[model samples]
Target chain A: MIVAANPIGQAITWINDPLNWTNPGGMLDRLGEHLTISALAVALGCLVAWPLGLWLGHLGRGGGLVVLISNATLAIPTLALLTILPVVFASGFGKTPVVVALAVFAVPPLLANAYTGVRQADPEARDAARGMGLSSAQLLRRVELPLAVPYLAAGFRTAAVQVIATAALASFVNGGGLGQIIRTGFGIGIAAGGGQIVAGGVLVAGLALLAEVVLGGVERLVTPKPLRRGRQRLGRPRAADATGSA
Target chain B: MSFRLSYLADPGNPWFSWQYVRDNSDTILAAVREHASLTGRAVVIAVLIALPLSVLAYWFRPLAGPILAVSGVVYTIPSLALFAFIAPYLGTGATTVLVGLVLYALLLIVRNVVAGLNQVPPEVREAAEGMGYGRWRRLFRIDLPLALPGIVTGVRLATVSTVALVTVGVLVGHGGLGQLIFAGFQNNLYKAEIMTAALLCVALAVVLDLLLILVARLVTPWSPRRAR
Candidate 1:
């Protein structure tokens, strides 16, 4: 029921306030907290997804299966999960529950990418590795791992962006983040010009875009040099296809 | 040490009692109906808008990059952030979440549809042209059928994800099962409310996904295997 009539103006005031910028729960702290949660979540996601993805990819047996299952998980609503999890973890309250949900959220992309990255490696090269007498472990570590870097990077970045966006829900669970401001501001209604909610929403959206741009840059850098050059030579159509879907 | 399984079977709990269902049937039915409408309307609207856009994207080679980039960016924005951002303009209630869900549905549907159309074999198009089929006729009769797998996949993905997202609508006061979930949270882990809410959400997702797959199969009888 609470919303400012002059929402945009309120946002400007909330975002610009020297006091709002300075306190423990200020914009800076919330942003930092959000980034921390995202980083930890993505890291944890990689831990859950990487090994199985890599194994299946190397074997060339179940990469698609793993990817399919993981992608299904990606469709699970984070807000729903965030609320549902706390009940399961009755003793758990805030960050831990948030982190667990987010970590699970991040897994699908990483799993999919890790699988495709390894499985899509040039078959001739893989055959050569086998012909050269590489053990399974050697084939995975020395051959497949390096080639999968780009896929790993893509997965990591995608999952990171997803986590960063979804992490805003953490505040609903009392987990400290930018969501608190929006929740409280909205709860209080049109008073204070509805600026706090507007400001919080802006900050979260801005953070999500920032993560995408930064990760996109990192993805470019991690891609194999030859493929990177090849991609540019092939130009925009090829590039668009690569990012056409998540 | 506390026993976890007992929580579900607690005799006093509404979750374990049919009486609770009878008592709350109207409220439960409304919430379920609300969630379904939110997801269904959003998906249908998204498909109508996105399907045309997808055809255009594939037709205009130059537009592909911009279209995909825009959708990808939109996809990353948190649903709540977008919901909150537009809430003031949309002015609360079901419309707010509907618009938000519609926006979220566009990227996936558009991408998959276009991808499906693009993957139609060149040889098939050549054959269609060789047979003197008109461009528009060939597209509808041939190309569209070939692309059915991917298009159906897009629909399936969007349907399931939208079902999951419907619960988040409660944050804006429009969610189906989410009302119960939020109540459970607010009521300090009311076991009956939280468990039932969670179970319903999970059930909705599974049921919707299976239903979509069945529909997809009936539509694309030729594509025996699942479209990857």
Candidate 2:
């Protein structure tokens, strides 16, 4: 059989080759690494960002500061952070720098969303809760948190997908991820590794898309049942909202 | 510890050194210029393409779903993957990077365009129609004016994100500040180079974002600052 000449065909061939998946540092290993790093970063981001955003949002005092901080962080280039953190912090190149950078990268959407979600909870419900003698904590837990679930979910999905995508940059710092495949392909020169590069791209893109779809479903599932029914009404504008920010 | 010239000249590995910045000012400036130009051009082209497409989507509701979906899918593609995918075909250069950045910018711009058009009050459009304004004229004169804030918001978002994403284009050899960052990393982890480039990239994003905000305010003098 003749080797396929075009990169696309070669990419297909590359994916078909079992050796590519099974070898050490191959697709499977890289895929695992990618998932692990992304998960870790997102988890870290959520842990730090969500509570701060939620508490501040609930108080309604620090929205300005929160937005300001998040926006400022957003401007810092991910690649720059990824490269510089390891050296400046003396952390050495690897997953540490990658995860820290990605976690920082993930924070803006999560924090902003969590804050917005809780802040936008129904005013009537909050008043009723307050009148009913429910404490602020109780109100947050029973009323606002539930109301904020959708926004929180949206933010989570955004952060997760973004972390997964940016995690590929880890390859630049000798960190593990599926980006290794693409980097390796480039290292081999386009003639020979063109297929490899394309395959790597397809894999990363596929993974990100898969995450998006899965998270989208999770978003729908986690939404309150009532909101689910009214979602058609609420969902349309929110779709535009999500797209604009995320 | 006494501050010493030796530390600046330290061959070991200094986190930052003004001397490096001074020596590489030309290279740094070039990277900054390239970064700014690539981001600016990509966003401009994206706005150009997204404007017409968004109008079609807004005009025909059915098109909005598919348009947003396609652009959403494109947006979801990781920058590295997108660039790598294009590089094989575009052969790794500014064009490939530009195409990828433009595609990334498309969804943000398109969504905002649709959202902006959505913001055009039905009554206003009707009033214009009642005044015998043609559909095109009403759209341009009435709907678009109302939509300006939203459209500008999208453009602002796209520009800032593009500034950051353009650094990823270094994979294809076109990342403006990204080259310096990558070079710093690859060249024995030169902190000054990486820091300088990174800080400059951030500054560019902030400057451009402010410029857009100023433009938005100038265009929509009627509306106070709308939180993006």
Candidate 1 lDDT, A1-246, residue by residue in tens: 544478898788778888897798888889889989888988888998999889989888985577556655644556657866765565457577788888887777777778878887888888899999999999999899999898888888777877887788788777777777777776776455367877888888888889888988999897867887643221111111122122
Displacement of residue A216 (Cα, Å) in model 2 is 1.0
Q: Which stretches of candidate 1 lie over 4 Å from their true place?
A: A1-4, A61-65, A130-133, A190-193, A229-246, B1-22, B127-135, B225-228
Number of clashing pairs per prediction, in order: 4, 0
User: TM-scores, in order shown?
Assistant: 0.88, 0.91
Q: Model 1 misses residue A70 by how many Å?
A: 1.3
lDDT of 1 by residue, B1-228 (tens): 567545434446444446656787787778778888888899999999998888889889899889988987777777767877877665657888888888878887888899899999999999999999997898899988898888887877777778777777766778787887787777755666666666666677778878888888888887668464
Q: After superposition, how far is residue A152 of candidate 2 from its true place, in Å?
A: 2.3
- CAPRI class of candidate 1: acceptable
Candidate 2 on B71-156: residue-level lDDT in tens?
Answer: 98988888889877888877877998899889988888898889999988888888999999997998899988898988998898
lDDT of model 1, residue B106:
87
Top lDDT: which candidate number? 2
Tell me model 1's lDDT, rounded to 2 decimals.
0.76
